[model samples]
Target: MAQLLRQLERICGDDHVVTHPHALRTYESDGLLQYHVTPRIAVLPGTADEVREVVVACHGAGVPWVARGAGSGLSGGALPVEEGVLIVLTRLHRLLEVDLANQRVVVEPGVTNVAVSHAVAPTHFFPPDPSSQIVCSIGGNVAENSGGAHCFKYGFTTNYVTGLEVVLPDGGVVELGGKAVDLPGYDLVGAFVGSEGTLGVATKIVLRVIPRPEAVRTLVAFFDHTSEAGQTVSDIVGAGLVPGALEMMGRLSIEAAEGAVHAGYPPDAGAALIVELDGSGAECDARFDEVVSLCEQGGATGVRIAADDAERELIWKARKAAFAAIGRISPPARGARADRRALA
Candidate 1:
């Protein structure tokens, strides 16, 4: 362990390698919180070349290393392997290119998911928006192949990634796919997208973008039972209507959201449904009516459609914060911080 730490310090500066117990605590677990392990060390590499050097060093020493993004992951993808180094990728973030004509953006793996959309939103948008887009990195999305409300219409991360530059397990760097669609070869990009870091580390990626919609409308419906809301979702899909976002929160989730953010959800409702339709104004209006009718058919007690952008954003914000809201519902255990210390 001492030799590996010395090698990492040599590869990256001593300042970039964290070995102290207090400093390494943050990398012990991801968002899941259930599984935890304090890595022997955490190394933050500032560039792809540095990442390659660190990986090579670890490979040479036969010490396993885990790749990590923003540490906001709900799954155990970023959990440290025993006695391994956690390669934190936050420092490698940089948007390299935005080809508007080709509708593709090339970015280093550590760039945040929302950063890409924010950069392009003025001109267009990247459509695979996970709820954690504001904080999660594109590289983590690639590893998890994450999906969210908007995916029903825009598709998942795999649909947007056209190419990847990777460091294989043996520390060899290679490029898979490219700007051109349907590159002549096996689907390495597809296989690597959702491999959950078991395959290799993504150093860079080419992402697809979509034109910003001219209009967006949000509608919320309250049903007596969750199954009724589910039926409505099925009916909407069965009618061949793809909503921009479709989200359902059960009674507990509704109470949590209302208590936390007050998104105007019906506190007494058994289930709440949030459905957004985005497109040209006329298309959205027509689809909105169809959605409302479907909800009514599925036993919706009441419905409220957002009349402005502010209201729409509030609805989405509540949905985005659902995970945190749910957490507050269950109070942390007594001496939780102390327990975490004991585990460490």
Candidate 2:
């Protein structure tokens, strides 16, 4: 173990290698705090080559290791393995390339999910958008195949990921896929994605982006019961209207979000749906009307359309904050995993 630590330190400077118990405690678990295991050591690699070196050293030492991104995973995917090396990849963050012509962006593993969209916001956007987008790393999303509210329309991480520069378990490095749409042979890139880090560590990623929609409309509909809202969702789809997003919140979730962000949802409503539609202005306007009619038919007690971008932002703010807002209603101890799952 001592020799392994020395080798890791040699690969990524001593300052980057962590061994202090106090510092190691922070990495014991990820967002899923229920499972915790303090790793024997943690190393922050600054570059892909450095990561390879560290991995090579660990492989030679016969030491197990795990790669961690922003540690925002809710499933303990980033939980440290006891006595193993935790390879912290945050230091590798860098937007390596942006090809507007190909609508592709190349980024390091540690880049936050939102940063990708922000980088190309003027012309294009990467659209997976998990709830934790603001803080979750792209690498973690790739590991979990994370999908957010908009994933109902834009698809998940696997849909956007085009290529990967991966460091294998045995310290060998390989490239899979690329800027092109199709690659010959096996779908290795697809397999590596959502493998939960069991395949290897992705050092760099190439992702597909799409041009911004011509128009966008957001509306909130309140129902007397959860079943009513579910029916409304079904009706909208049944009408062949593919909105960009359709998200539902039970009363508890509504109260939590309203308290956190004042999204202005009806207080007594049993359930609420945040519906978003986008595309050509004419098509969105026509479809949005049909959506409102369907919601009313499905027994919505009241319906409100976002009057402006600020209102739309606030509505989404509430949705994204729903999980953390649960604490406002429930006691800290009562905020169990089951309660969290309910919000999901």
Candidate 3:
């Protein structure tokens, strides 16, 4: 431990390398909280060069290192391996470039998922919005191949990732894809996006963006039973109308959310389906009408469409906060095995 610290201190100065137990505790777990392991050392690297140096030092000492983003992941992808170094990349957060004409945004791995959309919101969007977009990092999104409500239409993180600069396990740097598509050989970039941490660490990435839709309408359908809401989702899909997002929440989730954020929903409603349609004004209106009719057929007692921006935000907020709203559903446990347990 002392040797690793000394080596990191030499490479990035002592202040940047954290060996103190108290400070290292934060990196022990991610959002899941089920698994936790304190790393022997945690280093925050500000640049790709600094990260490569740290990886080289770990290689020289014959030690392993785990790359971490915002640690908002639920899969323990950022959980520190026993006796390994945890390389936190939050310090490397930066929006390297935004090419509006080409619809591409280059960002460091540590940049937040929401930051990408926030950067393009005034014009269009980056669209792969996980519930944790406000806190999760794009690098982690790439690693997890994350999907969210909008993914039913916009697709997953792998769909948006266009280029990546990675540092391989053997400590060699390579650029898999570039600003232009089909840069030559194999589509290595596609393979690495969801390879998690086993493949390598992504230092930088290029994301594809799209123009904002002309109109978007949110329809909230309240059903008397959970299955009714689920069937409504099926009916909506069956009608040949692909909404931007089709999310269903059960009684437990709806109750918890009502308690937390009261999005003007029926506290007694058995279930809720938040369907969103985005596209041309005519298409949105046409599809919106079909969705309402389908929900009614599926036994939805009441249906409401957001009439304005404020109403639309309220509808999405409750859905986005589903994780936190349902926290009371599980008890918090510390220092649990961060990995999956299999039965023999």
Candidate 4:
């Protein structure tokens, strides 16, 4: 172990290779706190070369290793193996390039998900917006194939990922896919994505972006029962109205969000459906009306439309805060259980 540490320190400065007990504790577990095991050592590599070097060192030493980004994964995908090394990628955070003409952006593994959308906002945007986008790293999203409320329309990480620079398990580096839509060979990119870090570590990613829609309309409909809201969702789809996003929250979730963000949800409503429609102004306007009518037909007691971008943001904020709100409202004894269920 000492010899391995020396080799790692030689590859990346000693300051980047963590070994002290206190520092190691921080990488012991990811967002899924229930399953945790302290790694033998944790190393922060700043470049793809450095990452490859560390992997080589671990490979030669016959030590297992795992790559971690932001430690925000809820599925224990980043959980460390007890006798293995944890390779932290936070130092590789840099938006390498933005090709607006091509509607694609290239970023390193450690860049946060929200940063990508913000970089191309108002004109174009990256579409896979996981609830943890503010802090979750893009590489982690690729590994988890994460989806957000808008996934019902835009699709998940696999859809937007056009290319990847990866460090294979045996310390080899490889590039799969590219800026083009289709590659002639095997679907290696698809297989690598959603592998939960078992395949390799993504060092650089090329993501496809899309032009912003001309119009966006957000609406929230209150229902007397959750089943009614579910029916409304099915009815909207059955009617062929493809909303940009459709989310449902039960009374307990509504109360938690209301307490945390004051999203103005009705306290007595049994369920609330936050739906959004986007496209050309004419299309959104027409489809939005149809959605509202369908909600009413499905037994919605009340419906509210977001008046502007600010209101739309607030509505989405409340929806995103639903899990945190559960923590705020649950008793201490049941908080862990509630969080587990929410993540599940």
> At residue 254, what lDDT does model 2 achieve?
90
When 3 and 4 are scored with lDDT, the better candidate is 4
lDDT of 3: 0.87
Clashes by residue pair, model 3: 35-338
TM-score, every prediction? 0.95, 0.94, 0.94, 0.94
lDDT value, residue 265 of candidate 2: 83
Better of 1 and 4 by TM-score: 1
Angstrom error of the Cα, residue 109, model 4: value is 0.8
Collision pairs in model 4: none
Each model's C-alpha lDDT? 0.89, 0.91, 0.87, 0.91
lDDT of 2 by residue, 136-243 (tens): 899999999999998889999999999999999999999998844575689998999899999999999999999999999999999989999998998899889888
Clashes of each: 0, 0, 1, 0
**Candidate 3 lDDT tens digits, 213-232:** 99899989999999999888
lDDT of 2 at 197: 92
lDDT of 2 at 314: 88
| Deviation of model 2 at 230, angstroms | 0.7
Q: Output the lDDT of residue 194, model 3.
A: 82
